[model samples]
Target chain A: MNINLTPGPSQLFYTVPDHARHAFKEGITSISHRSKTFESYFQKATEGLKELLGIPTDYFIFFTGSATEVWEKSIQNLVENSSMHLVNGAFSNRYFEIAKQLGKHAQKMDAPLGQNFSSIPITNYGTELIAITQNETSTGVSLTNDFIREVREKNSEALIVVDAVSSMPYPALDYSQIDSVFFSVQKGFGMPAGLGVWAVNPRCIEKAESLLARGISIGSYHNLPTLLLNALKNQTTETPNVLGIYLLSCVVEDFLRIGIKKIRQETDYKAAILYQALRAHPLMSAFVKDESAQSKTVIVADCGEHSIRISNYLSEHGFNPGEGYGEKKKSQLRFANFPAHSKEQYERMVDLIENLR
Target chain B: MNINLTPGPSQLFYTVPDHARHAFKEGITSISHRSKTFESYFQKATEGLKELLGIPTDYFIFFTGSATEVWEKSIQNLVENSSMHLVNGAFSNRYFEIAKQLGKHAQKMDAPLGQNFSSIPITNYGTELIAITQNETSTGVSLTNDFIREVREKNSEALIVVDAVSSMPYPALDYSQIDSVFFSVQKGFGMPAGLGVWAVNPRCIEKAESLLARGISIGSYHNLPTLLLNALKNQTTETPNVLGIYLLSCVVEDFLRIGIKKIRQETDYKAAILYQALRAHPLMSAFVKDESAQSKTVIVADCGEHSIRISNYLSEHGFNPGEGYGEKKKSQLRFANFPAHSKEQYERMVDLIENLR
Candidate 1:
């Protein structure tokens, strides 16, 4: 069997196929979102999300199409004129661009590729909200808790948001430090793609309402206020990806059974093993040099032209990792260490990588 | 086996379980969307949609969250300032409200519940676009071809968009009379909800470009230009419901194999038997009066106080139809005749309905 290790949409959580069978046999996917049956599914999924992530009761969670969509909705509902972005790679930079595309005064602090905020005192420059990418999937870099805590301390008046897309369930985020945070399921949750989970506190709702009072059109249908109203009713404003939500509930339950602390510890262990193997490789090395900034979930290696040979060798062993993104597409490889990957798999993968010519 | 006669999310196409099983075994859900594997799935789905729907070469098909989303997107891309709508019931009226919410000059012509336009010279009120819910799922009302043709001929200069949400693959819409149209797969296509298919011709793209040139912010990401630009690459602006798209492609191929003409004919026959049985019922009759306006797929009946008793009987017999929408929630039941429900199942439903006390 080919062991999928790509960052997003990587490997099925082993339990998904069986859970999907249950969804099909029970007609879970075919039930109306407004029906009591569907409401229960929705409730289970959202509640699981809260318990697994330790989300506060005051924080409201909403589902969107993808995490990329959360970027658009955030700018629409939270910011009136200006927003700040800490851009370390393509995904973070795209969030900044989304703000600009929505006709906002978007300011960005740029960090070079494969690098993240390692120091304190990141400024938002009077913007109404600051977007921090906690995990940069594109370059396998991440902002440390020290830097994030510093940002929260300095920008108490501004709305703080984080993209925990590729590193969630492992992040154990302090909800008090951020008003809003979002992620997609395919990465950290080890499910199929399509559903984006967005958690926002009461402050975020208040900000959205204020925008509405000021005659700002948040959106046509998925206005944050509207999403909140439906979420309160235990459903979404539109017919959602019911199956995705249901499967996510199953995986989150598994995560709960396994516990988040164990998942986080395993992720760190796997990441360490991969990085150590990268150091021994002839043509590959850890891309993010700073230990504090290196991502524990998505580990990148600068392989130059040897990426192809390494990939071929891994493929022969029934292993695969995600290709490098953007400008480094041809010269780097990103290995995801999400919960779907076990310690045994990582050890085997490390052996193969170290054995590569 | 309970026959899922509910309009949407009612029943899987039966082939779905096997296809989903195949998807799971192949790790289809976990692959990167940008990979060649995913592109092939995207290309297959879009191309299959075109073949099945007879979508012209110039028309671009894009996948969105749901048909409810297409309502917002149509307003964003096809209209600059003003648009007109034909509102028959809740779903159609919601589209009109979406336009107003998006800060557009939205005008509407309202029809009472269970009514449709039998006569025409249906006007667009000099608006740039006319939004028509081709088959309004709310009350099982539909606009006839004659009325759609009149609107097209009367306002040749304006764009004409359609919402075929709950009644596509059955309505052989004249794409020549419309600039854009969309539908979700749950209803007529017999798939799970969450993906909306939008087809827009070159004129729609031009209108969007002109609006952009005029400095109007058409929101962010999933913009028409960006969607089309990425569609040419067989992908989307963000990570899409990759599995949803894959399943839809499989279902559409099945549709092609059985042929659209056969599906429509089967729908008509099934609707006829159900409506005929409704006439024999003591407490229910066809919700729609005009024959041409009665939906072929979503056959709604005015059930009054007896809806529960009838629903209970049907439930005992292993069958369930959809509840009424909006104000008619408890007073009506909607029987859906999608391709997934076999002829034998419909005949059995008729027997059950006719024998109801």
Candidate 2:
């Protein structure tokens, strides 16, 4: 048996194959998107997500192709001229670039690799949107809840969009502090890649409508108004990833049954074990030196020149650790500690790291 | 045990369950998108599609959220100002609406519902694109290949775009005459929804680049150039529906093994039998008056006020025929003749329709 330790598209929860089998047996894959069955499935998913994430009553949930698409969609719908981004890694930087590519005046405050902002930056850039990635999968650096709250305090007028791509459920985010949060199911949700879930409060919706009323092209189909119109009827603007949505509902149900508090406890335990092992290892060290800034979901280690050998050792023993993102591909080994990844699996991983010579 | 005759999200091919089981067993769902395994899957799907569809070397294939999305992408990338649409049904009308929604000058030549154009319109409106739907799923009307060829002849300078959503592979389109063609996997391809395949020739690419150089927002992340840049490396712009892509490759392989010619032959035979039965029935008649223009893929019948009764009878007996789209819901019934629907199934459906009181 093989274990997937990559950040996104990580290991599937133990119940996934069985759920998929049930879905197929019920003709879930062959049903029409306009059917009552699909509507029930959509309802279950949206409600389950709201229950599990503690999403506000005023927030609306929408699905897109990927979290990357949300980067474009959020900018298109919310920002008419300018946006501000706080960048600490590759994924955050991509959001900034998307804003710029759409002809928005995008300004960014950056932090060095393996480090996170010590405090929220005060800016007078006249930005309409403020983008933040809660967890940087590239460097395994995450912002604390207090940091996000501070940012919100400083920029109360600008819409705050959070990228919770690799750090969700475990983050314990107060949704009341942000305007929008988006994540792909492949990451912490431990499902297949393809579906992006975006939760936005009424403020974002009002912004989109205001822009549309002013003759700014927010987008065409699948834009905020279109998605909202269909969503009110428990449908989508187009034929969405029905199977992905169904599976996500099932997974979220499982997570809720297990309880989020217990999941967070398990996550903290796993992160402590893995980080301790990395710090004590002879040839490896934790990439993020500040313990408070390091991500609990995606743990990265600075392997220096032994990245390949260490990854090979883990793979040979049935663990498939992910390489660093972009330029750090050869210098770091990243391990995902998603809800689907058991504590026993983390122990096995730590054993391998401890025995590495 | 149920027969799915609804146009899209219709029926899963018999091999799909077994293929999905194999996918689960092989851990295909948990693999990373950046891994070599994913690249191989991408390569296989693209190559399998090319071989099965006889797509030319100059045409580039890209995947999107849905065919509805391609309607927007094609217009965004290929047209700068104006587009002319040949509208006969709901799907065709939707394309024209999308173009108008994107702030383009969209013009249309309309035909009454359940009717098709007798001749291509002569236009010198300086249209940048001419859009046509080979098979309109909503009205069950299809344009002949001769009609498409005639349109190409009338407007040589305008890019020809075809929506082959419900009629792919069976139509055996001559790609040399068209600049771009797009389809969703749920219809003729007999897979789950959420994947849109867009194949564009080099001319379409050049058009997109020219628009981009002129500072048009053709889109940001999933724009043509960004998609092409990743396609060159056997990847997508974002974390795509990986399982959907894998399943499509498998289905295309199945088609190649059985041969497209044989599939087309079976489709023709089944359509003939169904249409004959509808013509002979006392309570039902063919919806499209013109025999030459009726679609072989989606066969529609005017059941008058007995539409629900016939559909109910079929559903109670294990077949689920589709209701008419939009305004025709009370008067018509639609049946799909995809590769997944066997000759035996079609015969069974015909027998039921003929004996209905």
Candidate 3:
């Protein structure tokens, strides 16, 4: 069997195939979104998420089409006049651009590729929200929890949102420090690409309500207020990805069974081995030079022009660690260390990397 | 043994379980959205839809989170000042509400509950687009083909949009008369909820470009320009509902194999029997008074107070024709006569209705 190590939509969670089969057999996909059956699925998924993530009591979890959508929704609902973005990679920069496209006065502090946002100070300057991509999927760089907390300390007035797309279940974030955090299930949750989970605190709702009070349009249908309204009733504003939500609930429950702390420990151990392999390689090294900023979930390595050859060679051995993203297509390789990936698999990946010619 | 005839997410196409199993086995769900594997799924689904619907060459097919989303996207990209809506049911009225929420001067001609838009005379005064819900799923009401065609003729300068959410593959709409049309997979397509297919002509593109030229915010990431840009490359603006898209391609191909003509003929046959049963029933009659206004796909009956009991009784025999929508919960019952619902099954439904206590 081919081991899919590509980031986001990587390896299916070990339980997914069984859960999906069960879902289909049970006619879970055939049930109406307005039905009590769907509400149970919604409640299970959202509650499982809150428990798994250690989310605060006042926070609300909402589902979206994809995590990329959360970027737009967050901007529309939270930011009335302006927002600030900490852009270190392609995905992070796109969020900033989305804010501008939405006609918000979006500002940004950029970092070099394969670098972290630890260097950037949070100078909010009247920005309604501060967007930080906690883990940059494109470059496999991440800001430390300490840096994120510092950002909150510096701009406690601005609503802080984190894009933990590629590194959820691995980040033990203090929700008390951030107003909102969003991620897609295709990544860390080990499901197919579809559902995006957005956790927002009461402050985010107050902001959206304030915008509504001022007659400023937040958005249509999926604005924060609308999503929260339906979420409270154990329903979505629109028909959601029922299959995805079902799978996510199953997987999150599986994670709960295994415990989040154990998952994080395993991820850390796996990332350490992979990075050691990259460091010992003859022609490659970990992309993020700063050890503190290196991602434990999505590990990127600089392989220069040999990236394609390395990817092909690895593919021959039934391993696919994904090709480079963005402009680094020929110069980097990414290997996702999701929960679905076994410890044995990462060891094999490390062995393959260390022995590469 | 449950025969789900709920309007959307009702009956899964016969081949769905097998196709889903095959997709899972083939690692379709695990494939990256940027991969060639995904592009193939996108191409097959889109091209198959075009052929099955007899969509023209100039029109591009794009996917969204749900059919509800196309409403917001259509308004955000196409309308600058005003758009006219033919609101008959809940879904149709919501589209008009979306436009107004987006700060557009949206106008509408209202139709009575369970009624058609035949009475709406297209008085387009500086309206950029004319929106029509070809089949309003909520009340099982439909606008006639002639009325939609007349709309285009009356407002030749305005873009004509048809929300064919529950009637696609049945409505052999003359694409030349409309600039855009949209639907979700779960409804008439007989797939699970998630993916929404939108067909837009080149004129819609021109209108979007014109709006863009004037610096109008036509939405972010999912704006027509961005969607079309990625769609041309057999991709979506973000990581879309991958499984939904895959299943769509499979189901659309299945539709093509059976032939859309045959599907439509069967639907017509099924609807006739259901409507006849409703007419002959003691406690129920067809909701739409005018036969021409009644929907062939989603059949609604005026069950008055016996709706729930009738629904539960049907469920005891393993048939679940959906209950009433919106305010008519106790007064009406809806039966979805989709392509997946066999003629024999509909006959059984009719016989059951005849013998109901």
Candidate 4:
């Protein structure tokens, strides 16, 4: 009876296809990790993912345990020297912290928490990588493509690694300017979590291999060259999440059927409806200043009271909103509209929020 | 179709339960990850796992995306340099490699790759932590409790960490003497890959907290302390593989109903069947020298010819034996007998191998 508006294990308010269920029950449960059927399934999912994301042919897609694993991989594979990081929110700051912990030469361009990612600072040419959080799930602030391009322009030699965990497929991705992009299946993919989707361009792949050749042992599981070889065939070197990969295939088929542009439009309409409802509310204010920079996927707002009160108020009535992540613990709440959420569900949520106010 | 005999993601070869299908379809897809019902499912699964494993009250059970995550967490929180590691095979060797990769001080007690893990060399216990792999899946070896007790007696201050990845309920664990144990659901748990089961003793928790109290960041998402807090409520900090988690619950129920001893008996019989078949062939010899070290889960053998040829030969028919891992490339092939394999299936596999030979 509870409505999940929390981000990430966001919500699947719609019916999962019967074919996916059948595959999980009849096919995946007993299949060995070494079987060809699983190999094909794993490969197809990765290929489908690459196609859906508009990644180039040179880009290889890998499946890992979590997007958080990508953080370690990024630190291990990239960032040999000082790197510039755009830290506008929680996940971004986390990346900076991870880089520091790995003893990587790294620096952060800090934007205030819960604010739009404005101008990124210039870095020295020796910076081997430039990192950013594309969709700041904690604050609902998204860094536009233009901002990324500017950073790329400033640091041409440095590889660009983007944590696109929350804002993929919906707005569609333009990987032409990026080196590597990573996400988990939970958010925009409308599937359960556990698997990380990584698309690495040939340049990034070569860079990772070069790092490996330098005798830097980037933990066996996250080893990019090993991952690339398996990813080429759409398989993981270690045991993979078979059911999740199968379900993601179903989701990919649905995406191709509906088309990404149509899905984006539909999602836009849903976001508009929710935003209109929020604007009408006297007690709430959007956390991000500009609507353009705000994420269409998640709605972060100051409840004009502590987030716990508003979150509790919403939860008591069956709707659960996102809690403030990072430092904005008390005053902010978030609402996520994932791929599977319906117009009716959005309406129900708004009505519930209105009643709470 | 191809039969999966990879030990894990091992072959399911049977139909999944009906209630699980119903739950996935009509019951729990859209339920909030934080909802009471969803929490109940998660909470019940953890409790069920603890009961199913006969875990002590003092032990804490948690969930992670993969057993690999457990590997990183074990190092991040548990080991503090001076830890002794027993490396009997490829999988066991990787643990110390990961520890070294993470800048932890770990010493290895090396056993020949295909030999049984005899005992831990106690003299090198510079740290208060000791790790052992329970079942070396790569070499088809299992370590006995007597070996564990011998190690414990040598280093009483050291916490014992066991990677029970390939030897969970199927072999029946006696955690009464162990501090922490980890396994993946993909193996003997009879579920799809993705979800990992982590159980830690109270002493390990205290040690983790003490380490955390210092400036050591256990990396976000994989942090053991935060993971345990969520585990107490049967929840994870990030999105979990809901489908895999649910399937694991069904698997636990089935395992408990069947009884651990009966399951072990069944797996043993299947292993014996495969071994007898292998012994009859002139072109084949058991991979490991010690028959006692041969795992009930998988039977590793020398195909006498190239392993790839034998693997391809068996796979051309209905049989799918696992490939040689790491440096054991040309000589070995592994025959896996998970609990799900039927007796008829085993006989058919033996027949196919005999015919192929």
Residue B352 CA error for candidate 1 (Å)?
Answer: 1.8
Worst 10 residues of 1 chain A by lDDT: A116-125
- Identify the candidate with maximal lDDT: 2
lDDT of 3 by residue, A1-357 (tens): 698988888888878999999999999998888888889989999999999999987799999999988999999999999998989899999999999999989998888888876565555456789998999999998888788888888888999999999999899998888999999998788888888999999999999999988999888899988898899998998888898888888898899999998999999999999998888888888989999989999999899989888998889988898778878877888999999898998888778877887
Q: Please provide TM-scores, in order, for all candidate models, with all chains considered together.
A: 0.98, 0.99, 0.98, 0.83
Alpha-carbon runs more than 4 Å astray in model 2: none
Error of 1 at A102 (Å): 0.4
Residues A54-142, candidate 2: write the lDDT tens digits. 89878999999899989999999999999999999999999999998898999999988889988545654467999989999999999
| Tens-digit lDDT string for candidate 1 (B1-357) | 877888887778889888888988888998888888889989999999898988898899999999888999889888888999988888889999999999999998888778886543455479899998999887888787778889899899999998999888888888899999899988788887889999999999999989988989887788899998899999888989999999998999999999999998898899899888877778899999888889988899999998887888888888888888888889999988788899989998788787777
Give a tens-digit lDDT track for model 3, residues B1-357. 688888887799889999999988888888888888899999999999889999997789999998888999999889999998888889899999999998989988889788886665566456898999999898989888788877777789999999999888899898888999999988788888888899999999999989998998898999999999999999999999888999999999999999998998999999988888878889889999899999999888998889888988889888998878889877888888888889988888788889995
**Candidate 4 per-residue lDDT over residues A101-120, each given as its tens digit:** 66677788788766665643
What local lDDT score does residue B281 receive in model 4, on the 0 to 100 scale?
Answer: 79
Q: What DockQ does each candidate score versus the true complex, computed on alpha carbons?
A: 0.84, 0.83, 0.83, 0.40
What DockQ does candidate 4 score? 0.40
Reference-based lDDT, residue A83, model 3: 92
DockQ ranking, high to low: 1, 3, 2, 4
Write one digit per residue (lDDT tens) for candidate 2, span B1-357: 798999988898888888888988899988877778888888888889899989997688999988988998898888899999999898899999999988899999998778888854555546899999999999999988778887888788999999999998788887878898999998898888889999989999999999999999898888899989988888998989988888988999999999989999999999999999988999999999799999999999999999999999999989998999888888999999999899999998899999997
Model 4 lDDT at residue A118: 61
